[model samples]
Target: MSNRGETVNIAIFTNSYLPFSGGVPTSIKTFKNAAEKLGHTVIVFAPSYPGHKSNGKGVIRIPSVKAMTYAGFYLPVPFSTEITKAFRRYDFDIVHVQHPYLLGETGMKMARKYNIPLVFTYHTMYEQYLHYLPVAESIANPVMRKFTTSFCNHSDLVIAPSEHVKEFLSKRNIETSIKVVPTGIELRPYRKKFRKGSIKRKHRIPQASKLLIYAGRITPEKNLKFLVKCMAKIAKKDPDVMCMLIGKSAEKDHYEYDLKDIVKREGMEDRIMFIGDVPHDKLIDYYKEADLFLFASKTETQGLVILEAMAAGTPVIAVDAPAISEFINGKNGFTVPQNMLKFTAKALSMLRDKKRMKQMSSNALKTAKKHSAENMAKKLIAEFRKVKPTQDEYENMRSLKDLSEIDWSDVIKKIMR
Candidate 1:
């Protein structure tokens, strides 16, 4: 640890970052900003893919020799041990691992070798990932659960984004100390533009058209096909009703193309538009312009978009899952059953009802102001300080794993000192 009295230096390991706008990437971005604000230095180690560009703010981009995307999911082909070697040299105070993938695994090994306290944040539900791997759920879910549980077990502290995730891990004996820190959003940017803004005109969206928007990756797990299916019905009911999807396709450009083809086939092409990717600063515009926010995915561990949309003053129409329900309620948005037709009907019903629609928008903005990234970062820093080893605990972390190998009296004296 640096002699710089309580100043923290965190090395964050994540599979993806900006140029990628899903739950995990966004969380890192916000957390980094918050940490810096709290007088801490944060360095992010993430995958360097096609759209990823380094901002040069202590974040190091480790490029993948090869990377591929399928159906909007990005997979970085496992690469060199150069990262692990460098991490040992950095000697960071804490190593926080975001995902349980290749980068995280390498970081974990480095943490053990270097005697650094390791913390893990549980993000996605990989058990639901079996279907995407082209494996049967019966065979895939157990394997995925095992992998995730083992990853959590290795950490000194496990930070779960929700109570449900905490419960899931505890049921399986991930006995590490756990903290339920709901992911926080930075509200200043979104809340400042509470009323309608120039985002509609900037996107060539006509004033009379009621814009329905979905701002996320165009992936199967996201269940975007249902939104395309509903666009036809929404268009029939209100010709002025326009559905716009503003998100980038990671490795899943083909699936995105298929959806575009669906629009052309349904003759609903002109009614829907796709804006592949945009800068983080500009994303608030889409959220600001939407009359209603729609997310159909039940696969998310926590639907950050639902909170983001509500923060941007747009009401959400989401599936009734724990992740969705945790932040939203009847006062702020509508929750529909997971069935396609029901989802579509609920989305349309919310959009068409002007009085109820306006009220939800108000409730959404109020709810969103509370989830700022600054607040979340503050909470995380507090937790890191709490879980960090005391003089005695540090001795244990620095000692060999085998209890029999240590000089007990000398070690305890050093710890007491």
Candidate 2:
């Protein structure tokens, strides 16, 4: 593990990438860009999107079809002769896979063929995402767990973005080396100079309104319906308090319409605003402009947005979930159960107290400083150095002819179906 200053090449495979914003894409881009700044070469292999340009940036987009159920997500035709050729040319030192399906399996095969270390990041709790599948939960739950266990065991090392994910894997009895490394953001971006009322003025948010921002995907697993109900109750007490739901839905989730319906039914549409997706570069201003960050997702590995919000000196009011338990200490933020009354009471109390919110905001900045992107990149690079493949092992691996003989056309066709 002695490649501190030496240059190394890393090949990353994922089902999603930029033009699509989320924790997975943001985490990969942050670490990849940070590693590159340290003189390492990183290449991303992701699914191609319709009417979107890669514009270079070391990304190789594979041919794919738009996932109708999960809007903005593409299902890639994994069998690509061109990708195989590119793999042979780049000669990456290691392969890092973001998800444990489709592109992940392909990455594993290529890693074995080249006799390189294969590392998998356990980003999502597959059980939580089973809602997206049309299959029955009784059947899909075990299948996903089995598949996840198999994928992690096959890897040289498993990277867990948080202790919560690590604990989830431990319970599954995965017999692989697991490391807990929290994904970080470029703190300076959130700390940069931005006009104080710019976001509110542009969005037509009233100056006297007490702004609360929720920045994440709008999906069922996020427990957003409950949030809408809570906001409706809170609105009756303080009409000046406004709640904004930021970011696009991970899919065109049915929950989105339901949330809107609840808002309309309760006559809280004026108080609650759905300000679609915000650009990543300009996201900081929203965080900085807001008084508090609202996160109710029970299914996050690390909740990168929480850290981003903290970096902007905004305190978070979230549910008592394992994913975000590590970040909150009561001083920095408040964690409550899923109960609407309890959560609303806490949110209202925090908003009413100016002194407490100021202290929490300062504490939030202190917590954010502890998780720097540069430090996270260095930790990943250290792990990469620990998995160097020997020359004889590389020689013993499969040849290009053997790789080509495997029929991936059928596999790609199946996924397309």
Error of 2 at 21 (Å): 1.8
Q: Which ten residues in a row have the lowest lDDT in candidate 1?
A: 399-408
Clash pairs of candidate 1? 69-251, 71-252, 72-252, 185-371, 185-372, 185-373, 186-373
Model 2 agreement with the true structure over 375-399: per-residue lDDT tens digits: 8998888888887543433334343
> What lDDT tens digits, residue by residue, belong to model 1 across residues 47-102?
77666565568777665433222333444433556566556556588888897756
In model 2, the Cα lDDT at residue 366 comes to 87
The residue ranges of model 2 lying beyond 4 angstroms of the native Cα positions read: 250-253, 388-417
TM-score of 1: 0.83
Candidate 2: Cα lDDT at 88 = 78
